[model samples]
Target: MKSFVFRQFEIRQSADVFRVGTDGVLLGSLADIRNARKVLEVGTGTGLISLMLAQRNPKAEFLGLDINQEAVELTRLNFESSPFHSRLKNIHQDFKTFDTQDKFDAIVTNPPYFEASGSEKDKIARQTVELNFRELISKSSELLSEQGVFSLIIPAESGNDFMKMAQENHLFLIRQIHIKGIEGSKNKRLILEFSLTEKALEESEFIIEKSPRQYSDPYLELTKEFHVFKNRS
Candidate 1:
């Protein structure tokens, strides 16, 4: 697919990089960006999440970083074509080695969760060969401002371990939502938000579909601002 049209912006995905998916969309739409003046997105594949955040927070400046040159180019193109281009920037750099004196008010990512199990492209895009959960949490802790928030969506199976690692780094979980494919399906993904300050964890569940090819009401309502669907009544 060359491009995908959202309610506010159109994303160009001509480059052979990780394309936008449900996980990215969910994280982008659900992540809290209130009072965020500056935001950083690690592994910003095609800059989908950053673009969404830009649309949501017009005053916020965004920087999207990715190790893959192709992904960087694609994100740059996407950012440039959007209305919030002036507020957005895309850089070709690994998050681990990316040096910046500035800290962000919010850091978001949908990282590679699986261990290597697919093609070269898949491995680079889906596996944690470059940045694992531990390093990701540690780096976010270092680069985030005192009141900054870090948000991500990961596999449900790894949720407990990820929370443990985050706690070890003093990044306390503030909110979380478990995602299921259907009403009765197993939880597949977990969307979590963390902050440096300790707080009570708020938990919830999100179901994507009520039936085959039919979106659940909650999912539709949550994403109604961005996505246009048929028979959403």
Candidate 2:
């Protein structure tokens, strides 16, 4: 087991499951969760996002859903050992077939982005083998409450198509943040927030590093609470 220690909780990632990464941490730290009582994390690998959000929104209850049994069990353990264990739950079920009468105030995901090209496990983790963007958007729209918000981080190139799909499902873009590897790098990822109602989009850009291995000030500020060495000089 590989363990990652954050300021509030520790996450242990099993060798066979999806490991915690910057994308997950970014979505977890940046997603808006204010006044959200019921939150759901789709494809919650190792439960990292849920734990982070739980720390931010102390009153929210989190449900982590994953299709892989091993991933679900690993997430369960991670949640159980966290300080917010009482407010977190994990279920092993494919998002496409997951049936829930209860709706969510907020839903977040760091979904698969690439086409199939790697090993079986890697293909499932990276490719849309289990869940594609269209299905994810449609299903999430149905699961969201009237005032619900859906937050996600995806490849920057797929933004236009994703926004089209979201609009088809009656989900409108409310906020967008483009992520770059460094100050001069091209945008690589997009952090987006959508809602049921159409609103003027709030857009911004974030750079992870000012140079190789040098964390940008904005990145450090956003993740300062969770990263122990964010202030390294």
Candidate 3:
């Protein structure tokens, strides 16, 4: 298990169930949720994004779904123990199989990106529960209401493929934020927001750090609530 103790919340997550990482935090902070009423978090492994959104948007109701029973249980516990408990609900089910009559105002997810470097012994639940980039985009297109937004954090290398899939799904890119870990390091993640309404795409780059263990102000501002290191500086 991995433990993350933030200033306002504590998260206990499994190593296999896509541990709450920098990508998740980036997506949560950068996603636009000003007018969101109902939000869906697909594959909410530890309810990290759900909880974050709940705190960020007090008026929004969040529904988090996960394929693994253990993960759902963990998320439930986390929600109950969190300050945003009233706004959060966790369900144990796969996003593809979960039935919903109502469409959401916003959908956010930190999906699993299967890399060749992962080991076979890695938790099967994590690998199997993840929806591919194409799957997430297409599914979000179906579940999001008109003018609704879908925000996602994925490997930077896969941004082109994801954008293509979004276009194929009739979802237009509203914003794209390329995230780099450090000054000289390769871009590691991409934070994207999509909607049905066609609009000029807004793009920007975010560097997480200046050097090893030296975080940038933007990174610190976005992650101040979750990273202890951000507060220590």
Candidate 4:
């Protein structure tokens, strides 16, 4: 297990299914949140995305949901200890089963995508987090307010499939940022922002590092607000 302490939040994670990784960070930073007034984080592992959303939109309120009891407790503790505690709340329940009368201006998730072939841990994690593309899109569409955005990160291979599902559910791709570990490498992550309104926007790519030891300028600039040494060479 390893932990990362950022200026505003902390992640205690394992190589296990629930670990918080760079993909989540990329999605949280890439999400266009300046206009969001209310946010929902569907699978807030350690409350990282919720905290990031709160950091960027100080006036916004965040609701973080997770099915795992440990994760829920940890997120609650993390939120209370954080400087933005007043703006964040955590719910310990499966998103599918949780009932909320409110609609959010933004919904963000770092969805679990690996189809479980075997292993108990993998199976449980997938069941709790990963969802079929159709179900995810339809359910998210049901939850999102009209003209609201659904932002998420998932495996790059699933991008087009998820986008098709999103389209069928009346969600339009507003912005997309593909991410790779370094130059000329295969893209591993897709950060997506979808809206009900059809609006023209730019599409781009983000390389996290130029090489193993060198962080990309775009990555640093996007995350500099919360990650210390983000701009340091």
Which candidate ranks first by TM-score, i.e. highest?
A: 2
Candidate 1 Cα outliers beyond 4 Å, as residue runs: 231-233
Q: Answer with 1 or 3, whichever has the higher lDDT.
A: 1
Tens-digit per-residue lDDT, 151-199, candidate 3: 9888888889889989999999999988889987788889999999998
Q: List the residue pairs that clash in candidate 2.
A: none
Q: For residues 1-233, could you state the per-residue lDDT of candidate 4 as single tens digits?
A: 66778877776554443666677777777787788888888877678888877888889999888777777877887788788899999888777766778888898888767775666664544543355556667778888888789998888898998888888888999998888989889998888889988999669888999888788888888888878783344
Ordered by lDDT, highest first, the candidates read 2, 1, 3, 4
Tens digits of per-residue lDDT, candidate 2, 1-233, equal 76999998998887788898999999999999997999999988889999999999999999999988888998998999999999999998899998989999999999998876656765566789899999999999999998889999999999999999998889999999999989999999999999997889999999999999888989999988898883335
Ranking by TM-score: 2, 1, 3, 4
Runs with alpha carbons beyond 4 Å of true place in candidate 2: 230-233
Evaluate residue 177 in candidate 2 and report its C-alpha lDDT on the 0 to 100 scale: 96
Instruction: Report, for every candidate in turn, its global Cα lDDT versus the true structure.
Output: 0.90, 0.92, 0.83, 0.79
TM-score of candidate 1 on Cα atoms, chains taken together? 0.96
| 1 versus 2: better lDDT goes to | 2
- For model 1, how does the per-residue alpha-carbon lDDT over 8-28 read when each residue is reduced to its tens digit? 888888547888899999999
Steric clash pairs (candidate 4): none
Off by over 4 Å in 3: 115-118, 121-130, 230-233
How displaced is residue 107 in candidate 4, in Å? 0.2
Residue 230 lDDT in candidate 4:
38
Q: What is the lDDT, from 0 to 100, of the residue 150 in candidate 1?
A: 98
